[model samples]
Target: MSIKKNRLSQNGIYGPLTQKTLRNLLKKELITNFGFENMHIIADILIDRFLKIISECSVEKERIKPYQTIVFAVDRNQRFGYGKTMSQTKLIPVTVNIITHQELEELASGKYLKDLRPKIVTRILKEAYAQGGVLSLNDVAIICGVPNTIIKKAMRDYYKQHPDEILPHIGTIFDCGATMTHKRIIIKLYLSGLLTKEISEKTNHHPFNVDSYISSFEQVRGLYEEGKGVQQIAFFTGFSQSLVKEYIQIIKELNQLQNNNKPNGLMSLTS
Candidate 1:
């Protein structure tokens, strides 16, 4: 049958167009929610969300029909590049069924949003592990809001760079593979102050958090103009107490270093 023009609200089923639109809308909401600065990246978020929803539905009791073809739109700015937009080469697609409105609503809800955080984290971790052997604690904090404690605990006994290189634990319908570089990149981006949601959009790895090959930042400017401590900043940032302290220390140190580097005294006997 011709692809339906709109989402099947009465029956609660979604067609390709409906699915695409929902993906876009959901991404827009997520971008706003995360306070990301760009709109072009909406496409990235849409793609990532599409993969996640499909992956979850594919294996669950409510199976969705397998799509014969999938399309990914190219960004005008093309942050990654024309070649990066090609999913066949850059991304490894997993099988999944179409999603229902009920499921979508559940995920989109305010309460369920936090639960999905790890999934986004997982996706970036995949890339990081592939690119490098290890990822930093600060990196994990940015993408998933996962505290460094969880990352450290997860890394127990495993190689620091390639810990849990092959596992499928997040909100996916199936297993996937990741490398050390991928995990490292995830951590790097997190430390660089890029949120998982934003990176997901940028990387075109929709539904990024997966139980694939493996598992695995930043300066604290101010305390929201309020008299809050590490806990408050951590709460707002989804970081651990130790991480918050570390970032504050780093920023303070950098400032101090810069001040110290300034010319201590004016030169004398200048012509």
Candidate 2:
């Protein structure tokens, strides 16, 4: 039997306006409810303006199927990733709504469209995590109110200098292998001489939290430079020994790097 390809609603030639486009639905409504016939030319003209409007607009759930879903977050103590089964860890159910008009209004404007997309990605990631959901980059991009490639390009352009910086998503938060811990990554950025506010923006953390970390690391670094032991630095700084050691190691490495970059008998000023 020959497949009836021509039986498609728009004759299968104009497939771009299939059930997916609002223009198609509006065309059907004009025909079905307004007494217009299926082949009426007025229906096409009526939908043309709306098609133009859609072409200029952005949706939060761009290129996403189903537009939303319920994703789970594992308990804090359990390792969670794509391969983990339900029985292996305690789970928290979270409703992730990708196509939120509210998010679109909060995220987009004409002049700042490029500047705000990475922030939108970060905001969506935080929103899901705040509600006990762990969204991947794909899911977060859907809520960014732009194409995923454009959103990713904005993020990459902004964060290229600090590639290992962690954002609060399952891709980074749950990946315990090569990716650095969030706090450790922040400390590394600090050691690399980034300002606290810059570090906050890059790491998707609030400035207050970033400042607190900077204060803690400064205390640890001061004691370590004075030849204090890890336990002593931890006790003095009111931080864990592991944290103190981490800071000290980063400080030593930064110092060594600075020394290595200096020419014979000349001090390096870059650090």
Runs in model 1 with CA error above 4 Å? 1-219, 224-227, 263-271
lDDT by residue (1-271, candidate 1, tens digit) is 3345343453466344556675667666667776654765765856687778576434443432432212222221222322332453233323221233444577767546444434433544454434322223444554345686665455432334444243222211111222333343443344345666764544434333411211213223456234568888888877677656755554454445446665533111111
Give the distance in Å from residue 248's predicted Cα in candidate 2 to where it truly belongs: 1.2
lDDT of 2 by residue, 23-99 (tens): 77898888989988866787898789667655433343553346465555544334565677657866555555554
- TM-score of every candidate: 0.20, 0.39
Top model by TM-score, which number?
Answer: 2
Which 10 residues in a row give candidate 1 its minimum summed lDDT? 169-178
Clashes of each: 36, 0
The TM-score of candidate 2 is: 0.39
Give model 2's clash tally: 0
